[model samples]
Target: MKKILILANNDVGLYKFRKELIRELVKDYKVYISLPNGNLIPELEKLGCEFIETPINRRGTNPITDVKLLWRYKKIIKSTNPDVVLTYTIKPNVYGGIVSRISKVPYISNITGLGSAVENGGILQKVTLTLYKLSLKKAHCVFFQNKENEEFLSSNISIGNKRLIPGSGVNLEQYSLLDYPKSKEIHFLFIARVMKEKGINQYLEAAEYIKKKHPNTVFNILGSCEEEYEEKLKEMNNKGIIRYHGMQKDVQKYFRTAHCTIHPTYYPEGMSNVLLESAASGRPVITTNRSGCREIVDDQENGFIVMQQDSKDLIQKIEKFISLSYESQKGMGIYGRKKVEKEFDRNIVVEAYINEIEKINKSIS
Candidate 1:
């Protein structure tokens, strides 16, 4: 049986975005998973794959430690000796890409997001881009979640085999269209990492302003958080500006309840999973005009696109939605669900991976 090595930064990410793909691949290949240990390990192992606990500092930037990570990846891949290696996220795409190349193994990479280090564009971006250029040079294929991301990386580095998919593509079946909450009050949802880059402050500011004008409405926040930001989000939740549910496993409940999804992100993203999931759950999205964020929205068709980092615009957009009748708002959500079904179905992503793997296999043969 053909063997495949899957390397990533976190098990949660692999579970969230790549689980469908992993399930489809495992039937035909010997799947070996390498990632930092987390809650998803048991589920992953249950799917008949070997899981290796590889400690990774996902947000760290020490040069010495990063170099050591590459060494560790080399060791792991050397011992595993998989026919083809597939990796996702920043560290694995870069570090694992390099290791696979050194081992003379074909590898595929999914650029999930451009972290703050590269998105901020300073010395960090320079060093990171250099690493990307070196690592992806020999990759079998480089998959990007958005065109904007693909164009940005291509401009910085020469990636030969590149394919674009819509933000990992949501599973339409898994996230079925759900009935709206029975509450008479309107609800808006903000789901993303609780970080400044994701416009957490803007979300809070808009929530405060909108809630003041429209006392009957409510705003909800969800997703994981850093300690520094978690306290602030919790404080806001306590104050009743926005109800923050930190690190939710199932987000469809929030989506089913929301009249609209708000994602005013300023960070460079491969694509926003929150936007995709929101749309898949049959809810409209209001996000920034930023690259990855805008792909899910059609600006007044499915949802509105607010100005990035502009709290006032975010407030205005939320107010405009409030002005619309419930029926009209529901139509917007219906349109969003249709759009995701046509363009962001998980089957498309699954087939793409299968095709890519087959292409590589034939080439090797």
Candidate 2:
């Protein structure tokens, strides 16, 4: 049997995003997974796959610790001797690819997004981009979740093989729409990690402005607050402008009951799973015109796309939705459901991965 090894920074990255792909691959290959320990190990084991406990720091950089991680992964690769490797996230794609190259194991990488390093341009961005260009040059195949990212790689890096897949595909059947709930109040939901880059503060400010005119309108935020922005977010939550539900495991439940999903991210994203899931659940989206977020939303059709970081533009869009008739709102949501069915279905994406893997195997063989 062909041997496959998967690498990720955290267990959630393996569990939430790549679970479907893993399940499919395990049928024919001896699959091994490497990630930080988390709640997913038992479930992954249940799927008849082997797991290796690899300590990977999911957050900020430490040169000393990163070197240790590189050595550890190098050891793992040398021992496992897998025929093929798949890696995702910035650290894994760059560092893992380098290790795989040294081991002479064929590998594929998925660049989900350009995170802080590239988004917050500086020395780190320059260094990370250089590393990416180097690591990605000879990759068997490099997949991007958005065209903007693909374009960046084509223009800036010397990547030879590339593919573009939608954001970790949404299960259209699972996220089936419910009837638009009739309520005295209209609720807007924002689901994302509570980071400045996610436009959390912008959402709060827009909520405050909207509430002043339409006091009954509700603004709800469902996401985990990180240490960097916790204090400020808590203060905002204390005010009646936004209702905080922390991180939610089942966001589809919330999406079903809400009128619209707001994702005003200024930071570049790979196609956002939140936006796709929300649209799949039949909720219209209000997000930025930026690359990853914009792909899922068609302005004035299924949802609206406002300019990034423009609180005034966000507030205007909110008001526009608020003023729409009940039938018009429902129509927007119906359009979204249709969009999801036609475009972001999970099966389509899984098959795409399978095809890519097969192509890689043929080429290398």
Candidate 3:
């Protein structure tokens, strides 16, 4: 059987977002995954992936640590001797791509998102773009989740054999459509890390302002607090400004009661999985007018697109949603569901990977 080695920064994201592709690959290939050890290892093992516990400082810029990671990828690639290497996230994509090229192995890379370092621009963006250009020069194929990311990278680097895919498309079956709620109290959900770039402060501010005027409205926050916002979240949760459900494994239950999903993120994203999942669960979304977000929303049709980091615009959009007639609100959700079903189905991503890997395998054979 052919061997496939996958490298990523974290296990939870790999399992949560790309499990469909991994599951399909394991059936026909000997699949190995290298990522930082996390709670989801047992779950991935159940899906027939051999997990290689790799220590990765996902956001750090230490040269020694990065060199160590490169050495580790070299070791893993040499030992595994896989037919094709697959890499995701920043560190793995760069370090792993470099090692794969040196070892004369065909590899595919997924530009999931440009991290804050690159998106913010400055010396860091130049450094990162230089690294990307160096590592991705010899890649067998490059998969970009959003056109903006693709265009940015292409303009900066000489790339080959690139393909665009929906950001790790949502599973239609797992997030099946729920019945639109009939409650008079509007429920809005924010599902993402409680970080500054994710527009948490904006969400909180909007919640505070809207909750005061529409006292019956409910604001819900889900996902882990990766930064220093835990105390703030707790304080707001206690005050009834928002209900914080920290890091949920099953989000569909929350979607059941949510009238709409609000993801006011300004972070550079390849695609916003939260928006796709929310749309798949038959809920309308209100998100920023950025690349990852704007594509998921049809302006006034399926959902509203707020200006990035503009609390006033986010607040205005939230109020507009509040003012929507019940029928119109539900219709927006219906439209979102149809849109995801047509465009963001997980099967599309799975098939893309299969075809790409097949092409690589046949060419090498």
Candidate 4:
């Protein structure tokens, strides 16, 4: 049996997004995963795969610790001597790719998103891009979640084999649509981490504007709050502009009941799981005119796509949805569900990974 090593920064990357792939790989190979410890350790262990703990900071910039992490990962690669190394996220893809190259191990990487590095465009962006170009030079294949990222790499980086997959696919069966509830009021939902980059403040501003005219409409937000924005969001919640449901485990419950999901993110995203999940749950989406977010929504079809960071445009779109008849909104939701079935099903994504792994395996053999 072959040995495969998976590296990621977060538990979701190891446990949720790659669960089916890991299970399938373990059937024919010795599959080992390395990630920072999180809530999913028990679940991952239950799947009969080996887990290794590693220190990975998903945020912040520290030169000394980062150098130490790179060396530690290289040592692990030398010890594991796996047939292939699969990695995701920025730090893992860059550092892990370098380690795999040095160990003469075939490897693949997924560029989940450009992240704040490229979005902010400072010293970090330059440093990360340089690292990516160097590390990915010898990769077996590089997968991107959106066209923008793919185009950026092909044009800038020297990577040869490249592919695109939909953002980590949503489980369609689990996100099935419920019957549209009859209510005299309309509910708008914003589901994401409480970050300024995610357009949380823009959503709040739009909600405030809309509520003054459409007093009966309900605006709700569901996600964890970062310390920077918690106070501001809480103040808006107190004023009844938006109801904050912080860090929910079961967002599907809210999706089943909400009229539409609003994601006016200014940040670069891979493919937004929230938008895909919302659409799968039979709800329309209103997102920004950006790469990953725009792919899931068709303007004026299933949902609307407003200019990024434009609170006024967001408010207008909200009013447009509110003005529509209940039946029309339901129709939009139905269309969104159909879109998910056709394009963003979890099984489709899993199959893509299977195919990629098999292709790489054959080449190496």
Candidate 5:
């Protein structure tokens, strides 16, 4: 059996998002996954993936420690001698790509997101782009989650092979459709990591503005809170302007109960999985008209897309949804469900990955 080694920053992310894809690949290949050891090691092992714990600093940029990571990747790859390698996230794609190239291993990479380095835009962005150009030029195939990122990277670098895939693809079976909740109150839910970049401020601004007018409507936030924004969010929750659900493992449960989902994020994303999961749960979405988030919706048909970073535009769109008849709102959600079924099914992503691996094997033989 061909050995396939995969690299990622953390175990939880690898297990949570790519579990299905890993399951699909393990049937034909001896799959090995490298991530920082965490509680999810057993879960990945259950999927038949050989769990290899590798140290990775998920946050921070200490040059000396980072250089050690590069050397460790080289050591790991040399020992494994895999036929093919695959990687995702920023650090893995950059460091792993370079190591795979140096070891002469056929490898593929997935650009899962353009995080703060690119979003913040300054010296960091310039340095990040330079690193991407150097590391990604030699990969066998490079997959981008959204077209905007694909266009941006292609314009900036000399990439040899490229493929654009729907953001990590949603599992329809798991996030199956649910009947719209029957209630006199319209419930709008926001599910994301609570931070400035995720547009938490715009969401709160809209919620604050809309609450005075529509007393019966409910605005709720369900996410892990960041330290800087935690007190402010808690204050809002105390004021009864919006309810804070905090972070929950079963977000699909929230989706099933919610009438609509709002993701007013301006963050440079790979693709907003929260939007996809909400859409798959048969709920209408309200998101920004930006790259990763916009690609998921049909604007007005499935959900509304508002201007990024503008709270006024977000308020207007939320109000527009409030005016819609119940049937129309439900129709919007149904359209979203159909959209995912047609375009962003998890099976499609797995098939594409398998095809690339097959091509690599054929070329070698």
Candidate 6:
């Protein structure tokens, strides 16, 4: 069997979002995965991937660490001698792309997001754009998660071949339509890292405002705290404003009772997986008017769209959800499920990769 090597920053995202693609690839290829060690290694290994314990400082901007990562990718590519390389996230995509090009290997780069550094422009953005242009100029194929990302890269850099995909696409099977919850206490869920860029403060402020009036309503928060919001989150939890369930492995359980999902993120996302999964699970979403968040919502149809960074607007939308009758809320969730079924199936993403890999194989032959 031919070999396909994968490079990424973390195992959680790879296993959570792209496990289906990996499963499909393992059936026909010897899949090698290089990423930072995490909880999902055994699960990925079970899917027939040879795991390479790669150390990557995901948030650092140190050039020395980046050089080490580049060196590591070069060594992995040399030793594994894979037919093709697949890279995800920023560090892997940029550094891994360079090594793949120099080693004469066909590689596909997945532009997962522009990230905060790129989105919050500066000298760093210019440096990042320069690196992306240098690295992705010769990629076999570059897949974008959103149209904005595609347009941004196109204007800023020269890419040979690029395509847009549905932000990694939700597994329709895994996130099957759930029964809309039937309860007097309206439950709203927030599923993302606890960070300002993700609009956690907006969610918290809305929670505080909404809880003051609707005492029976519950606001739930899941995922790890990436920043310094733990104390505030805990205080809110104690005050019965929101329930902070830190880093849940099984969010579907939480989804079972959630009436709606709120994602008020301002981050430059390739796509918002949380929104996609929520919609797939037959729960309506209320998110920002940003690219990744807006694409999934059909404003007052599947979910409401709030203005970015405006807690007052978010509170108003939450209040709007509260005003809806139970039947109307359920109808909104049903609409959301149908929307995901039509547009964001993971099989579409899998098929795209398979087709691209087959084309590369044919060219090699």
Those runs of model 1 whose alpha carbons end farther than 4 Å from true positions after fitting are 229-235
Candidate 5 on 147-209: residue-level lDDT in tens? 989998899999998999998899999999999888888899999899987899999998999
**Clashing residue pairs in candidate 5, if any?**
none
Q: Residue-wise lDDT of candidate 4 within 181-240, one digit each (tens)?
A: 578778899988888899987898888888899998889999888899888887988988
Residues 119-176 of candidate 3 have per-residue lDDT tens digits of: 8899999999999988899999999999999999999999989999998999999999
lDDT of 4: 0.86
Instruction: State the weakest 10-residue window (summed lDDT) of model 1.
Output: 175-184
RMSD to native for every prediction?
1.5, 1.6, 1.0, 1.3, 1.1, 0.9
Mind giving the per-residue lDDT tens digits that candidate 1 earns over 1-365? 99999998888778877888889888989999998889889999988789988888988888898898899899888888898999898999999998899889999999887778887888999999999998899898999988878888899898899999887898888888877556788888888888888898898888878778898888888888867787777777788878877778778767777888888889877888888888888787889998888888889988999888899988888888989887888888889999999999988998989999999999999
lDDT, each prediction: 0.87, 0.85, 0.93, 0.86, 0.90, 0.94
lDDT of 3 at 357: 97
lDDT, candidate 4, at 230: 80
As for lDDT, the candidate ahead, 1 or 4, is 1
Error of 1 at 180 (Å): 3.0
Candidate 6 RMSD to the real structure: 0.9
The predicted structure with the larger lDDT, 2 or 6, is 6
Best by lDDT: 6
Candidate 6, residues 106-137, lDDT tens digits: the string is: 99999999898898899999999988987899
User: Residue 106 error for model 4, in Å?
Assistant: 0.8
Per-residue lDDT tens digits of candidate 2, residues 279-309? Answer: 8888889999898888898899888999889
Rate residue 350 of model 4 by lDDT. 77
Checking candidate 6 for backbone clashes, the offending pairs are none
For each candidate in turn, the TM-score is 0.96, 0.95, 0.98, 0.97, 0.98, 0.98
The window of 10 residues in a row where model 2 has the poorest summed lDDT is: 228-237
Tell me the deviation in Å of residue 335 in model 5: 0.3
